[model samples]
Target: MSTNPRGPNAIDRHVGSRVRLRRQLLNMSQEKLGEELGVTFQQVQKYERGANRIGAGRLWTLARVLDVPVSFFYEGVSETLNQPGFAEGDQTPIIDDFIQSADGVQLAQAFARIRDSKVRRRILELVRTLAAEEAEAQAAESEQA
Candidate 1:
């Protein structure tokens, strides 16, 4: 099989995404992580973006700094590799893409703060309705085009 000449294979990207997820979950800044790792914030950005591959030693340091086990980065990797999109060379997972966004984080934090289960369900229903409407609008626009 031909390899990516640019940078970072699927495993690298997946690992990087897990790192990003953990960092964000802890509300840790790339600059802070860089300080802990003795690297620049730009370097941390590269690692998170999968523009640069992280070595084993550095990965270990990252796990320690991020307060997770070394194996945390490998979770869900098998399932991701087996997905149809992976075969088609689509590296970005939809859920990860959403969770990595600022809006997604804010929404998740806010949703989690709501103690009422019934209210949370209503909010979920509202979001679903909005998403369905958006999908319908896009479908209609595409048909017109």
Candidate 2:
């Protein structure tokens, strides 16, 4: 394994992503997080963007500030590791990726807030119908093309 410090490794990126996800879930801004860690917001941005590697001491501090266990940063990381019968580290962490996105997070939060089962079902049905219609439209467009 190349120990290049010019850029963050995949594991560093994954850990950084987890940090960003947890911070966003709490609606904490980069500035606030940086303030708590005694670093600039730009450093936090670099961390989130996987442009810089975070040290163990800083990671421990982040876990404490974020009110999460250190293990939280390693969740879903198995998908990124080399596995047999497949390209090394080629697996997609689809579910985790979605939960980490702003739209996905917002949708999940909204869905969870809906206490009515019927409402949730109706929302799901509405989304399914919209997706189906969009798919059909795209197919028709391709056929026309």
Candidate 3:
């Protein structure tokens, strides 16, 4: 064995925090969520603490149970949006704001309904392109300020 110890970093903690927050907002108990996910409450605790990695399949199941997209865990989590990342405590408020948005919830639902991998990739690409364009526009506006 390589004796490598697995541990979550700042980003993982951020994702976990988002998951916990959404669960709370939906008035879900960790035990209830675990029952839905076929996991133990302890496992749910691990996920909420970022003590274990959530696999893609498990994440998908979680999204369904949470009534959100897998991407919902990552919203408001970009490095640019959070200075010093989650470690500096800057992203929590942003994540909370994102979770409260109707548009964000709609987007999450739309993302969850996309089954085709290629279509999902295309959607991500399109969103990235749109975000880039928006950023450019913002930059232009700032320059004129």
Candidate 4:
């Protein structure tokens, strides 16, 4: 149960996103993760969705099961969360969601296997050029409409 009426806290969501990201990167299913944690897959889903708060003990277990340090979950947490008027719509969560997706994980794994820095740089440049072209095409289409 979230303490705030507004759903899961930002920190909880961030932690959940990290959990999902790591789990996906490892190519582990939620069912497998839950089996290792001795919990139901539904419970694992809740943890990943931030619907349920993970206690310290459970978090420690998660770290053990996931083979990540407990601090990994907090790696990219914003320093300005306590500041007034902090914007909630950050790109990190979007990127996290993508990284947790099947296609994104596949792409990331393939990219990681590329040991040549020049090849990696060329692939990145190709991707950027494609993205810029897509964006320009969309803008032109919108103007035409």
TM-scores across all candidates? 0.83, 0.81, 0.53, 0.80
lDDT of 2 by residue, 12-127 (tens): 88888899989988999999999999999999999987788999999999999999999999886666554455664553766667876888888988899999999999999999
Best candidate, TM-score: 1
Task: Give the runs in model 4 whose Cα sits over 4 Å from its true position.
Answer: 1-7, 79-94
Report the CA-based lDDT of candidate 4 relative to the real structure: 0.83
| lDDT for residue 20 in candidate 1, whole number 0-100 | 87
Error of 1 at 37 (Å): 0.7
Candidate 1 achieves a global lDDT of: 0.87
Q: For residues 28-143, what per-residue lDDT tens digits would candidate 4 score against the true structure?
A: 99999999999999988888888888889999999998899999988777731344455666565567667767798899889999999999999999999999999999999999
lDDT by residue (tens digit), candidate 1, 1-145? 9876776987887888888888888899999999999999999988988879999999999999999999999998876677654565555477678777767877888899999999999999999999999999999999999
Which portions of model 1 show Cα errors greater than 4 Å? 4-7, 83-92
Lowest summed lDDT across 10 adjacent residues in model 2 is found at: 82-91
Candidate 3 lDDT over 61-123, as tens digits, reads 989999998898887667534664357655556655565455665577779899999999999
lDDT of 2: 0.88
Q: In candidate 3, residue 39 scores what lDDT?
A: 92
Arrange candidates, best lDDT first. Answer: 2, 1, 4, 3
Q: Can you tell me which runs of candidate 2 are displaced by over 4 Å?
A: 1-6, 85-92
Residue pairs with colliding backbones in model 1 are none
Steric collisions counted per model: 0, 0, 0, 0
Answer with 2 or 3, whichever has the higher TM-score: 2
